[model samples]
Target: MTSSIRRIPRRMPGWAKVLTAFVLVLVVLFAGVRLAVLPGLRDLFGTETQDRSGPALLKSIQDMSRYDAASGNFQVVVDLEKDAKYLPDVLHGSRTLYVGAGTVDAYVDLGRLGGNDVTVDADRTSATLRLPHARLGKPALDPDRSYAVSKQRGLLDRLGDLFSDNPNSEQAVQKLAVRHIGEAAKDSGLTARAETNTTDMLQGLLSSLGFKEVHITYRS
Candidate 1:
């Protein structure tokens, strides 16, 4: 007598099969359009960009009186999302992942110094200076280096873009990024670093001017 063996094949679920077919169709369509139609269209009709804005007017210039003690470069990632109640993300929601690069400058306002802010000793061998604490400037975002890493929009959003002028606006995310960067800079000891640098600079300058003793203090 010989032994017999039986084998049973597994079948994929109906929903899974449908989902796989849908995904495959989308992929094929996207690939075909990207590899075939896009290049042909570009070759047939080359693209041209035009700038129609008027020449920039010269704005009023103000004299700067602050000493830039330290400049801090910062980067932040902003993830902004909006969801509709009881609606799936694919149907009515948006999410954006943005990477923002910016710079914050800490400065001391030398122009605010009063006549008595700096005092020289009668012997001309010692000096004392009173200066204000360093303040951080507004965050300036770098457009070249800052950009959206990824964006996901619902079907309704995509449909609305067809009629909207500014379809892809990153203003919300950009603002959030700037705010985060500013907060980070405040906690990064940037102001302390700036104060140290300013003190060192003033001390060196005064010493070079023949003052053997230089004392510097900052006002809150």
Candidate 2:
């Protein structure tokens, strides 16, 4: 009986051995699939599910100023010598005021042209400007007169408006303004124009005013 039991142990079936080997192989593959393969696949396909809330492109450009906690204001000084003509027209005639928290008031005095004041109020999404008086040549509208207007419409309406406007007239005005401003900047001996520096300065000022986002647009 002891010898028979020993023989039974030695003669175990090959099929059973092969089955055990296959089972071990499957267990290894299953572990690899769960730990490596699945995670890689999820990362490849699920990128949009990651943290999406962040500052917008325009907002990033705007918030480059340092705030004064004591005064409760953010300030950036712009020397208008370089582009004096463009500065006044763009600021007063064009209606493009620095949009941010509290109010943005611009004071400009250019010799014979005199001084003008512009105020822009901080609306959460955009700015609301109150123009007490803006004089541009004809006192109505002039090609050389720079001005900005803000409009709000649905996406579709904005797209339509872009096409419906007189393209040639707009181009002519833009070219004239650019040429005039370039000349004025050279004459004034300004190293850099205010428009170039205002975007980021306005944003930082707005942030100091407790706004998280700011959008500034140039209008004619």
Candidate 3:
């Protein structure tokens, strides 16, 4: 029995196994940083390096003061039903329940500012800018978060589903949901916050660039 027993194979050194695992971990980490993490970080902190106008360099680059401060993700379950006006409901019937998520962004646009909207003091010590009214961007539906929660279709509708083309009530529900998200953004006071944030950011930036006084105003 002892002679028949299989000989044991030599084990690898503990240090060699540890080194292999460490290399694998490093490769994974590097791959993740390169593929996913770095690109997003770059966009969040990206800045333009346009020339600083004038010898004194008191230029007001009223370049779009984009404030992506107010962000909202809204989830809504919308029910859509086809109506039978003056006819039997069973003839056309339907209902689709959708669970959708929408993303909205509100920004303060200084893009309306022209050369006259910016005022730079003679000694480059003071500056003032007139900013345009803040506005909300279009609501975008996130396909990942947006989908049909549950749909109950009438027999005729289910039969029609197999056929060629027909108007989708779900699309109408989605459009309404998107419009609601946009209205919600306006009611959420995003514009006020964007204005305040833009003002503070421009003040600090100008103050740092040798301007002792910075004035920022918004117009409707």
Candidate 4:
């Protein structure tokens, strides 16, 4: 008598191979979304910043120009919020935050002048001046005066913030507040007053220098 045995096929079928590859691709995509993309998405809809302390935190930024003719000081309270949702229609998945008590400084620059800006009348009795338009300088936020108004974060957002290295959200709000203040100051005739003050000072100086008639004008 003779005995026989059957062997099972070891090679995978084409359909099964394709299905396996597809699953692997899905897993890789999911991982990428979970790790890399999610955090960015949070901030694309979010903001954050490093926490600085002490004198470093009280950073002062101003023009080095020695003469400041007129100054407009403003006090602003900013309340802001943001929300991020992987899906926007069905539900509100993002959180919002608030920042408050912001301030800004606007001043006129008299130290900046062209060489031929000042003209003297022929008799050495009168003088005229040409001045450039007034402009705003960079904003400097006073940390001590500012505060975090409030914040409400979703679970996903809180999770997202843990890993994000973006700039401080409060700083963004502070900047916006200061910007608005600067705009308002400009519109409220801050520059005009500055120009007037400058003219008065120059007139007084010219009088002391023995000039009788003074003519002043702005280039802008």
Candidate number achieving the greatest TM-score relative to the actual structure: 1
By TM-score, the candidates rank as 1, 3, 4, 2
Please give the distance, in angstroms, between residue 204's alpha carbon in candidate 3 and its true position after superposition.
1.7
TM-score for predicted model 2 compared with the true structure = 0.19
How do the residues 1-220 of candidate 2 rate in per-residue lDDT, one tens digit apiece?
3554444457659999998986876686466557656757656554365677877555344432222111111222111211234334333222212111111122211222212322344556444222122111111123232332332233333234447855212343344444444343343423223332444566677778876656543322
How many backbone clashes does every candidate have? 0, 8, 0, 5
lDDT for every model?
0.89, 0.37, 0.76, 0.64
Tell me the spans in candidate 2 whose CA falls farther than 4 Å from its real position. Answer: 1-184, 187-192
lDDT of 1 at 167: 88
Per-model TM values vs. the true structure: 0.80, 0.19, 0.63, 0.57
TM-score attained by model 3: 0.63
In candidate 3, position 134 carries an lDDT of 73
Of 3 and 4, the candidate ranking higher by TM-score? 3
Candidate RMSDs in order: 12.6, 26.8, 21.6, 10.9
TM-score of 1: 0.80
As for lDDT, the candidate ahead, 2 or 3, is: 3
Candidate rank order under lDDT: 1, 3, 4, 2
**Residue pairs in steric clash, candidate 1?**
none
Model 4 misplaced regions, further than 4 Å: 1-66, 85-116, 165-169
**lDDT for model 2:** 0.37
lDDT of candidate 3 over 90-196, digit per residue (tens): 65667778877888877776556889889998999999999887777899988787888676655456446647476344677788778777777777887788778
